[model samples]
Every structure is written in structure tokens, then in C-alpha cells.
Target chain A: DQQVKQNSPSLSVQEGRISILNCDYTNSMFDYFLWYKKYPAEGPTFLISISSIKDKNEDGRFTVFLNKSAKHLSLHIVPSQPGDSAVYFCAASARVVTGANNLFFGTGTRLTVIP
Target chain B: EAGVTQFPSHSVIEKGQTVTLRCDPISGHDNLYWYRRVMGKEIKFLLHFVKESKQDESGMPNNRFLAERTGGTYSTLKVQPAELEDSGVYFCASSPGTSGAGEQYFGPGTRLTVT
Candidate 1:
């Protein structure tokens, strides 16, 4: 079963606009969420994260909003640049419950930025 | 500081062949994890190691796969009598802290193809 899901397989946005990517999870035990950006032929790089206690977290042009009650999270990139075009993956973990701290990841959403 | 490094960026082997992949984590990082992503699927955890100890391996698929971190410096994963279903991109990640609060740094994955 897929605990984390990224419903959208792809997304497109114009440059300097806001790009929003959504993710949902069925597991209520997950308390920590993270987003990773991956370019072709490269590994997924950590972007930003949020804890279940907080509703939102921001880092520069990237912001992640979490709704625990809905078991959903979204990553927003304001003024998205062409460089932001890549595959974005949403991941979650139940850190407190598991000592291994393994992560469960979404299928990933490919983002394309138009100049 | 160097990031996590994976060997054999791409490998193609026939069925019944044995293949071994290696990962070298960042210096001073004690937490190492292995994850795999099959075609069009989400990344799945294979196992996790804290130094030289195996913390959790519940995600390991079968007996054909073996993982080891002998000196706590590097890890290796071996697949014996590879099957077509075992083809995927294998990724290694590492974090610095003992707790699960730190962000994981990933390595360029090794793509394994079983023909």
C-alpha cells in the first residue's frame, strides 16, 4: 500500500509565478514531512521540511504547509525559476515511533517551468 | 566535505548473475539508509544502519538481497541470482545525528538492470 501519494504526475508553471505541488498520506502516524528536489541524472536533494506540530514552514522561496487533520501537505515555490524545473518528491516519517527513522516517499511530481 | 558516494552508476546484469553495489557515506555521519525506486513507483526503504549495527530491515524484499556495513564507514548491498523484478535505482542516504531530526543527504543512485 502507498502511504504517501502525489496525485499529480506532472505540473507546469510560468517563470516568476507560484508553483504549488500537493501530496497526501493515509498514515496518521507520520509526524515529520520533507520535500526533495531531483534533477535528471542526479540524486534527490533535500529542500524543506515541516513537523506535525507546525502548520507551515518556510525557506527562502520555498514554503511547505501541512494540515495534520487532513493528512495533506503542499509545497509552494514563489517566483519559480527555470532552475526549479525538476522532479519533486514528498516524504514522511514517524520518527518518534520508529528507531530506524526510515522515510516513506511519494511517486514524485515532475515540474516544468516555462520561460 | 564530500557527500555520499555510490559506485557503479549503472549496471546491467543477466538473470542468475550476482551484483554488488557500494555506498560511501559522508564522513562523521553515523546514519545510513538504503532505498530503491522501481519504474514509475515511489522510493521504498530497504534498510537502515546506525554505525555498524542494523537498526531496521523490515523493508527488505527477500533473501536474495544482502546488506552489510562492516566497519561503519561504508556499506554494500548484494543481490544474488538477480531477477527481472529486482531492477531499479538504488539510493543511499546519510545523516549526521543519532536522532531522526537531521536532513538526509543522498548520493547519485546506482541503476541496476536485470535482463
Candidate 2:
């Protein structure tokens, strides 16, 4: 079963507009969420994250909002640029009983920002 | 100050072959993880290591896969008698802290093709 899901397989937005990507999780035990952006043939880079304790987190042009009651989270990039076009993945993890960590990821959403 | 590094960017072999993928984490980082993405599927976690010991390997698919970390600095994943289903991009990630709350740095994945 897919615990994390990204319903949209692809998205397109105009430059300078806001691009929103959504994700949902079926497991209620997940308390931390993260977003990663990946370019072709490259590894994913961390973009932003939100803890279950907070509803939102922002950094530069990226913002992530979490709704625990709905088990959903969204990543918003304002003033999206062509460079922002890539595959975006949403991930979540629960606290480890030991000292290590494991992440569950969603099927990525391919975002295209038109110039 | 380097990110995670993976060796053998791409490999192609016939079925029943043995393949090993390596990962070098950032210096001083104590957490290591392995993930894989098959065709048209979400990236899935394979395992996690803290220091020199495996902390969680619940995601390992079968007995054909083996993972090890030596000296707590680097790791190697070996797939013996690889099957067609093992074709995918394998990624390695590391974090400095012991908690799932820390941000993970990823390496360029190694793409393996089993014919």
C-alpha cells in the first residue's frame, strides 16, 4: 500500500505565478514532512519541511503547509521561475525508536514552469 | 563539505549477475539510508544505518539484497543474482543527526538495468 500519495502526476505554471503541489498520507503516525526537488539525472535536494507541531514553514520563495487533521500537506513556490521546473517529491517519517531514521516518499510530481 | 557520493553512476547486466553499489556519506554524518525507485513508482526506502549497525531494514525486499556499513563512514549494497525486477535507480542519503527530524542530503543515484 502507498502510504504517501501525490495525486497529480504533472503540473504547469507560468513564470512569476505561484506553483502549488499537493500530497496526502494515509498513515497518521507520520509527524514530520519534507519536500525535495530533483533535476534530471541528479539527486533530490531538500527544499522545505514542516513538523507536525507547526502548521506552516517558509523559506525564501518556498512555503509548506501541513494540515494534520486532513493528513495532507502542500508546497507552494511563489514567483516560480524556469529553474523551478523539476520533479518534486513529498516525504514523511515517524520518530524512530532507535537513533536512525527512515523516510516514506510519494510518487513525484513533475512541475514545469513556463518562461 | 561535500554531499553524499555514489559510485558507478550506471550499470547494466544480465539476470543472475551480482552488482554492488557504494555510497560515501559526508564526513561526521552518522546516519545513512538507502532508497530505490522502480519504473513509474514512488521512491521507496530500503534500509537505514546508524554508525556501523543497521537500525532498520524492514524495507528490504528479499534475501537477494545485502547492505553493509563499515567504520560508519561509507556503505555498500550488493544484489546477488539480480532479477529483472531489481532494475531501478538506487539512492543513498545521509544526515548529521540521529533523529528523523534532521535534513538528509542525497547522492546522485546509481541506475541499474537488469536484462
Candidate 3:
């Protein structure tokens, strides 16, 4: 069973525009959400995260928004650059429910920025 | 300051062959995790190790797979008689603290191909 889902397999945006990636979850036990960006040959890198208690979290040009009721979350990148083009994965952890802290990840979405 | 390191970035073996993958976590990180992503599927959790003990192995596929972490440092995952379905990218991640909601850093994945 896939607890987390990213319906969009790919997204394309022009450079300097806004790029938004969306993700959804079926498990209500998930209290923490994270976004990971991966290059072609590299592992997924930690990008941003948000806790269930907060609705939005922003760092530099990246921002993440979480909606507890909708069981949805999104990653927004402003002024998208060519370097930001890569695969983005959405992962969730149920810290309070399971102390093991294993993450459940979605099938990542590949993003391309048109220069 | 080095991130997690994985050995044998790519491997190809017959179905009945045995293969081992290694991962070295960041210094002082007590939480280590293994995850795999088969083609066209989401990244799935394999196991977790805290120090030299096995914290969780519920995600392990079968008895053919074994994981060990000795001296609370590096870890090794071995697959005997690896199956064709085992072809995928394996990722290793580590976090400094016990609560690993958003702090886990990952290494470049190991791609395994069993024909």
C-alpha cells in the first residue's frame, strides 16, 4: 500500500518562474513531512520540512505548505533556476506513532526548468 | 564533515549470485537506515539500525537478505541468490539524533542489477 502519493510524474517551468510540486498522504498518523531533491547520480538531498503543527515553512527560495485536514502538502520554488531541475521526492514520518522513524516516500517527480 | 558513503555504485550479477552492499554513515550519527527503489515504484524502507543493534527489520523482503552493523559504525547488506526483482537502487541515510524527522542525510545510491 502506498501511504504517500505524488500524482504528477513530471513538471516543467521556465526559469525565473514559480514551480510548485504537490503531494498527498493517506496515513493520518504522519505528523512530519519532508522534501528531498536528487540529481542524476546523487542521492536524495534534504531540501525542506514541516511539522504537523505548522501550516507553512520557508527557507530561502523554497517553501513548503501543509494542510492537515486535506492530507496534502506542496513544495514551492520561486524564481526557478536550471540548477533546480531534478527529481524531487516527498517523504513522511510518524514520529509519535513509531519511534523507529522509518520514512515512507512517494514515487518522485522529475522537474525540468526551461532556460 | 563528509556525508554518508556507499561502495560499489553499480553492480550486475546473475540471479543465483551473492552480492553485498556497504554504507558508512556520517561521524557521530547514531541512526542509520536503508531504503530501496525499484524501477517505476516508490522508495521503500528496508531496515533501521541504531548503534550496533538492529532497531527494525520489518521491511526486509525475505530471508535471502541480511544486514549487519558492527562496532556501531559501518553497515553491510548481503543478498544471497539475489532475485531478478531485486534490481534497484539502494540508498543509505543517517541522522545525528534519535528523532529523525528531517535530519537524515543520504548517500549516493547503489544500483544493483540481477539478471
Candidate 4:
């Protein structure tokens, strides 16, 4: 079963607008969530993250909101630029063992920004 | 410092062949992880290593797959008699902290094609 899911396969946004990508999880044990951006030929790059303790976390133009009660999270990029276009993946992690954590990733959402 | 790196960016081989994918985490980072994305599926965790030890390997698919971190600096994932279903992109990631809270850095990924 897919514990974490990104229902939207793709999204397009005009430049200078806000781009929101959504994700949901079925596992309640997941306490940490992360967002990663990936270009076609490169590995995923960490974007932002939020702990279950906080409802929101922001860095520069990227912001992540978590609704633990709803088992959902979303990533928002304000003034989205052309360079922001890429495949975005949502991942979650819990303390499965001591001194290490494994990540469970979603299918990913492809975001395209138009000029 | 350099980011995580993977060798043999792309590999194509027939079924029943043996293949080994390697990953070199950033210097001084003791945590290493292996993950893969089969076609039409979400990225899934394979295993995790902490300083040359297997901390969590519950994600490994089966006995056909083997992972090793001999010297604690790099890791290798070998699939003997690879099957067609094994064709996918394999990713490696590393983190510096002991907590599950640390952000993991990813490599470019190795694309394995089983014909």
C-alpha cells in the first residue's frame, strides 16, 4: 500500500504566481516530513521540511504547511520562477530504529512554471 | 564539500546478469541509504547503513539483493541474476546527524535497465 501519496501527477503555473503541491499520508507514526526537488538528470535536492510539532515552516520563497489532524501537507512557492520547474517529491520518516531513519517517498508531482 | 555521488549513471543489461551499483557519501558523513523507484511506482526505501553497519535493512526486496559498506565510506548494492522487474532508478542519500531530524542529501542516481 502507498502510505504517502501525491494524487496530482502534474501542475502548471504562470510565473510570479504561487505554486502549491499537495501530499497526504496514511501513516500516523510519521513525525517528520520533507520536500525535495529534482531535475531530470540530477538527484533530489532538499527544499523544505516540517515537524509534526509545527503547523508551518518557511524558507525564502518556499513554505510547507502540515495539518497533522488531516494527515496532509502542502508545499507553496511564492512568486514561482521558471527555474522552480521540476519534479517535487514528498517524503516522510519516523524513528524505526536507533540512530537511523529510512524515508518513504511519494510518487512525485511534476511542476512546470511558464514565463 | 562535495555532495553524494553515484557511479555508472546508467546501466543496461539482460536478465540473469549481475550488476553492482555504488554510492559514495560525502566525507565525514557516516549515514548512507539506498532507495529505488520502479516504473509507475513511488520511490521506496531499500536499506540504511550507519558507519559500516546495517542499521535498518527491512526495506530490502529479497535475498537476491545484497548491500555492503565495507570501509564505512562507500556502499554497494548488488543484484545477482537481475530480473526485468528490477529495472529502475536507484538513489543513494546521506545525512550527518544522528537524529531522524537531519536533512538527507541525495546523489544523481543510477538508472538500471534490465532487458
Tens-digit lDDT string for candidate 1 (A4-111): 999999999999999999999999899899999999878899999998989999999999999998999999999899999999999999886664489999999999
**lDDT (tens digit, per residue) of candidate 2 on B1-115:** 7889998999999999999999999888888999999987999999998889898999999999999998898999999989999999999999986544567899999999999
**Tens digits of per-residue lDDT for model 4 on B1-115?**
8999999999999999999999999998889999999986898999999989999999999999999999999999999989999999999999985545667899999999999
Candidate 1: regions farther than 4 A off: none
Rank the models by DockQ, top first: 1, 4, 3, 2
Which pairs of residues have clashing backbones in candidate 4? Answer: none
How much does each candidate deviate from the true structure in C-alpha RMSD? 0.9, 1.4, 1.0, 1.4
Model 2 per-residue lDDT tens digits across residues A1-115: 9999999999999999999999999988887889999999999999988888999999999999999999999999998999999999999887633333588899999999999
Which is superior by DockQ, 1 or 2?
1
lDDT of 2 at A100: 36
The candidate, 1 or 3, that scores higher on lDDT is: 1
Q: On residues B28-59, what C-alpha lDDT tens digit does candidate 1 reach at each position?
A: 99999999999989999999999999999999
Residue B9 CA error for candidate 2 (Å)?
0.2
Query: Residues A26-106, candidate 4, lDDT per residue (tens digit)?
Result: 998988899999999899999998888899999999999999999999999998999999999999887543334788899
The CA lDDT of each predicted structure is 0.94, 0.93, 0.94, 0.92
